[model samples]
Target: MEPDIATQNDSGQDSESGLSLRWSARLSLTTRILVVNVLAIALLAGGLFYLNNYRDRLTEERLTQARLQLTIVADALSSGDIANRDALVEQFASHLGARLRLYAPDGRKVIDSFELAEPTYQFVDPDAEPLRKDAARMLDKTIESVVFTTQIPNFSEPANDVAGAWSELETAERKSAAVSSVSYAPDRTPVIVAGKSLPDGAGSILLTANARDITRIVRAERASVLLVILVAATISILLSLFLARTIVRPIRKLAVAAVRVRMGRSDEIAIPRMPGRRDEIGQLSRALSDMSAALRHRIDATEAFAADVSHEIKNPLASLRSALEGLERVDDPDLQKQLLDVANDDVRRIDRLINDISDASRVDAELARAKFEPIDIGKMLEQLLAAREQRTSNLGVHIAFARPAKDVAKVMGDGGRLERVFGNLLDNAVSFSPEGGLVEILATPDGDEIVIHIADQGPGVAPDQREQVFQRFHSDRPDGEAFGKHSGLGLAIAKTIVEGHQGEIRILDRDGGESGACFEIRLPKAL
Candidate 1:
């Protein structure tokens, strides 16, 4: 028979399904959390590293400026080309925009820029910008902003007035060292000071540059950086929310749907479709929805099976009841024997119906959990034909076995179940065959599959009833066959077992459209 497309595709589908299941199982909760948070953590770490290096550069630039000023002044002090030391000191301090102090070894100040510069200065108060003309005139004599230089000229104990500056210069002179430091002056101005000892004990030259400019620039840049960081954080938060909605929320919904399916409410649960999205989550959602639909279909099929079982069992029960009632009333000895026989037959028929019904009901679940092993199809069919031929010897019917090639019909499935499947098919073929007719069982390799054919020389099945023959309790036994001899479950059970093994089974017209039914089964070859 030609293979059914669904059955033929099952092997490939199973392999793909297994891979997907393995990947889903590997993604635990912790792994998912790490995947979601890694980007944000990396961004924060990179920003921090960049800011740290930038601050270091800023600090080094400020220090380098101070060092350069100190070196120039120290070099001038040791130079013999200058005729006026005071003029040279003044020129250096003005050009560099710094405070320069030259102290002799005894702590005597030779030249001080603070002492030389004019004391008077004008300052504007921003708070007085809107004052009236009369108000401004009245406050002209008042000390609005300008202040005089506090450095006293030629004062004794100059070391006490500018202690930090004096201490650095004295340390440089005594130790013949060079020093660079950042500190605050007495007036609270930020200062970058560098002092180096002059050559030949010419005293120490101390250069102090106001660090306010660099400090203010750094503070402004830091403020700007903080603003940028805040903006970036806001954007990241928005993007994270969008990602969470797309990924995390859908996954959570799928989780909930799975839980509902497990709780036996799959039919009641509705999974949202995300067909447009081409992402991992979208694939997962689609898979979950398919699983739910399959589960619902199984549930519906199970319910129908139960209903059919009830209807089938009630028939023999009603016959047994009627036979028993008739036996209780009949008086003639022959009539009583006939009634007893009918009751006995009805009891056996009921028993057969119950057993077959039980087996059919458990077929789906059993096959789902059935473990499979490789079995040689040719050998299995040979053994089955031998058993059937032995049993049916007196009936003058025989099941004959044939193989296309020796040792080439190996297939993967439950060996016992496969044996049962062929056993049923051969039994049905033998029952349908004429007296002394041969029922042929043939196994052949068909590409990746092993195909088995069971042919009989009986009246063939009609085209319209071909599909209905495998339905539960649906039968078309020959005229001479005894009533209640068949439960009509053999073909149905065989079909289920073949499908469970990822194989296909079908009824085929015998060669040249002659009389008789031919059952064909196709099973995947063992690797």
Candidate 2:
């Protein structure tokens, strides 16, 4: 057997709810906020990678300077006596802060600056450095690896410290021009070397410099940039979380409250209305709270209406049942006829009650969807009076309308509903008026509103019962009038329709101190 319809509907709803949950869970608002904030810091941190190029340029400039100095020294030695070359090399090495070496045409070590004078510079051994320096080296190595993707060969002395072991010197001799190369020291500092061929093929001069300042400057700049990025990232994350809390928390609360309302647990839920906030979220909260209150009111009113309908309907049903039972036992023709009349009246009352209840139940919905247009209250009342005169011989009760000036009593409303309102009031006035009594209608413009008054020469309603007369099934008819002739919903429905049209209706005493009830209606004038 197929599954029950309710079970199928439940499963369908569950699947849809699960799909929504999964979709929303994929990326939370907080994560999205964090990512958007952090992305800016990441872009700023990209400057760290550019330091590699900066260091390379610094090393290349230092190597160029070394090459120029070596060429000058070799030129000076080539022009001078060979005996003074060692002293000149020692002097140049001391002045330039570098190590100088002279090579023969056959790659033999001719003159060495270290042998003639004290050493100019030496490389620091990284393994013997302090922890802080080790960390600096690690950072330098990491940056180089990330940017260049390849390691620079470590700088080292030639085997046996001979001239032939220097590759740049051979390259300069072969090319007959200055050449340079660079490598990294053990401490992650740059070591630059340049070579120049001696004039007239005498030999070649090789100069080596430990350009540690280049690495120091690049690492210093990188550290500063990283520090800025770290601070900015921290601030961005904190602010993102703050924004999410302010935005997402309220929305989550609304969602939870809405879910409770949808689950029929609204009586236990109090939707928060953030009155202090002036933002869109605050507006949304207030709107939702108001909507929830309206929904609750509608539900309570519907329950009350159902109960009232049951009570009202039961009375007529009971009377009809009693009359039918009496007709079954009564043998006399007069008694049977009387019972039949009673049964017919009860049936008519039941029919009228059902019709009024149906109309009352749907009035709100129909008015909500009704399209309103400008209607002239004067013309409408005049036409209503004419039609009533034609349809019913008012038993000597006369209706006189003091129509307003042209365009003075125009209002925006559904014409049919407005006509029904006037028609109900007119019929009520006629029913209560004595024979030959006058019913008067007057329409006039009062500021932005069009006011209409229907006054009847009848026993006026008591102050205590004026409000009660508009309630459903309230039948305080005039003396000698048949009971159940009116469903008592006429005034209630009139009040509902007037309120729907953004108007008001109230009972009042006639202005002239005459003993009659005056029903005043006020409707907003059409612009």
Model 1: weakest 10-residue lDDT segment is 148-157
lDDT for each residue of candidate 1 in 355-431, tens digit (9 for 90 to 100): 88888888888888888888988777767667765676326776667665666999888888888898787778777
On TM-score, the leading prediction is 2
Superposed model 1: Cα runs more than 4 Å off: 1-68, 71-75, 78-83, 103-110, 118-165, 184-190, 196-205, 216-235, 259-279, 398-400
Model 2, 1-527: lDDT tens digits are: 44222222545655455445454456878887898789988888889887778777787788888778877887888898888888889888999988888888777888888889988877888788899898887777787777764567889887776667888977887788889888888787878889888887777788888887887798789889989999999999999999999998988888878777767754767689999999999999999999998888889888888888999889989999999999889899999999899999999999999999999988899999999999988888888778878888466898888988888899999999999899889878988899999998889899999989999999989999888888777788889989888888999899999999999999999887998999999999999
List TM-scores for all candidates, in order. Answer: 0.75, 0.85
* Residue-level error in angstroms, candidate 1, position 426: 1.7
Give the deviation of candidate 2 from the true structure as CA RMSD: 4.5
> lDDT per model, in order?
0.71, 0.86
In candidate 2, residue 526 scores what lDDT?
A: 94
